[model samples]
Target: MVDPRRFKSRSAVNAYGGLGIGQSVTNWHVVGRSRASRRGQRAVKRVLFLAGRAAIRGDNALARRYANRLKSGWEDRKAIRDVARRILFVACAMWIRKEVYRDELVSVPSPTR
Candidate 1:
């Protein structure tokens, strides 16, 4: 599986380095907040959707569980938020560990399950 970190461009990596909210670069406040514009929200949604889709093929147990819920009639947008939440949760965990986001078996069952 492709490492999602590789998708981060050089600039993003630099941005991550300068990130003050936490250690993970992807943990930007705009991601979880209502501060972004409509277009920005759409973009973030796309990213979250793509990440959730990819997670189905990955070791991210949370993502897989979310995908399953999606298949069971949950709205795609809600499922995407679940993915975003998982992403943020992992990001926070990474921040606490002083490490970058790592692909792991996210042992917890998904909330939507």
Candidate 2:
């Protein structure tokens, strides 16, 4: 596992340019229908995206988040990107605390929509 501290900031983990988490809402653009951008770490982004998909296929907080996003009318890629971003944050937190991931740490309520 990669050391979270090495990232220094959440933006580093997300790697969508030097933009912070708030800026990510506008700055982060996943290149799905075009050539890949040379900005962020493509390999890391790919891994996170895949992890999000795997999480959605299982019973976990990430899956719940994915479901909620979908229920809220988010597009598939958008919801998956949201999950990937969340997974990055959670992974960083766990790595920094030197603790294993516990689904209980995240409380995703059942989707009402």
Candidate 3:
């Protein structure tokens, strides 16, 4: 198990040079756009990205959340980022509780007006 206290919050994780939150678009033209940002911890970011992709490929709360976000018209990268953030929070919680990850614990709420 890991130390949950190592990360104070989701934003802390993102600021630690792990998540790709630092990335930003450099230019946007009528025909095309360019993106650029400060380099984060490549290894951590890659692992997180892969984990998010894997979660999306499986039948779990994260996967359902990703699909829901996509259906709601969220951009692909934005959806992926949110997934990764969720993963970080879940991991921290699991570590703190000394329990295994559970789908039911991460339930996706039904859409309501």
Candidate 4:
């Protein structure tokens, strides 16, 4: 039995699809098309890698904020993952809100060390 009402964040859904969560979606076709275009695939991979690196640094506020959350449990790996998850959530929410990623709102971080 599957819960159709279940809500998953955009990235989570994408990841699930990428991981073969349930039935196959047309995502593979999309990915194949993306990869077929060598330039597009390279650009995408570069962007993803850059974003990942930025998250590890102090420049990305979203990552910093999520790091604070993980501080409660003192698990760096889990914290970084949570931050990545939130980043995807924010991207999805922004798309739904028909707006761009506002650095001002998401940039502010806690005054903790």
Candidate 5:
């Protein structure tokens, strides 16, 4: 098996740093609603945010459609955060199941057998 994490350029990997929300490493707000506290690993937060944006950039992915659905009811950043949360949840499930993620399995919707 090969490592799934690969980038074509060092700058491409480093590019996410500039996308940071500039909050402390412990907590950051995607939406600062009253009485709502958001907290997580800042590095992971940035990656998830960037991943959401990337998903939105490409029109064909199911993730993009999911983001669009969320965007209709919320701000773009908030929608992306929702997508990021979904991504995080899916990732955690994959980790628990010991399954490798297949974008094909996720990106396209198929009929039930």
Candidate 6:
């Protein structure tokens, strides 16, 4: 499952609906229809979006702070996407390195200056 696509970088994971996490409309030029097909797996995108939602609602303070920090400038859904992107990045790193997930090791810089 990890190397099936042989992703070259963390950004590749966003192809799984990472770009459209909080977007109601992906295409801006074509209002009614699109001239081209959209990329990425829709199922994975939904799953990732759900995971973002869960991250904010769950009891993980780190995840909460991460999402909250983003909220200062972004909409709630956008913040969720940021969290989802982080999730994808971390998942990719852990999978590539074969490392176990340790929440304590994942740190977030304070939002305040």
Report the number of the highest-lDDT candidate.
2
Which 10 consecutive positions of candidate 1 have the poorest summed lDDT?
15-24
Q: Return the top candidate by TM-score.
A: 3
lDDT of 1 by residue, 1-113 (tens): 12335424533432332211222236554334432223323454465557666776665666666767676678776665566546645654565567875555465444443
Candidate 3: residue pairs that collide: none
- Candidate 4 per-residue lDDT over residues 1-113, each given as its tens digit: 03312435453433532311233238554322221112223443344445544776766677667666655554554454445445555555676677887766665345354
Return the TM-score for candidate 5, rounded to 2 decimals: 0.50
RMSD of 1: 10.4
lDDT of candidate 2 over 1-113, digit per residue (tens): 34567766786667652112332233577433442234676677778888889999998888988899888887898788778888888877887898998998876756666
Model 3 C-alpha lDDT per residue in residues 36-77, reported as the tens digit of each score: 224656676667778898999998999998888888777888
10 residues in a row with least lDDT, candidate 2? 17-26
**Per-prediction RMSD in angstroms?**
10.4, 6.0, 5.4, 11.3, 10.5, 5.6
lDDT of each candidate versus the true structure: 0.51, 0.72, 0.71, 0.48, 0.51, 0.62
Instruction: Put down candidate 5 lDDT per residue, 60-104, tens digits, no spaces.
Output: 454655655664565566566555655655565575568987665
Using alpha carbons, what is the TM-score of model 6?
0.65
Who is ahead in lDDT, 2 or 6? 2
Pairs with backbone N, CA or C atoms under 3 Å apart (clashes), candidate 6? none
Global Cα lDDT for candidate 1 = 0.51
Q: Decide which is better by lDDT, 1 or 6.
A: 6
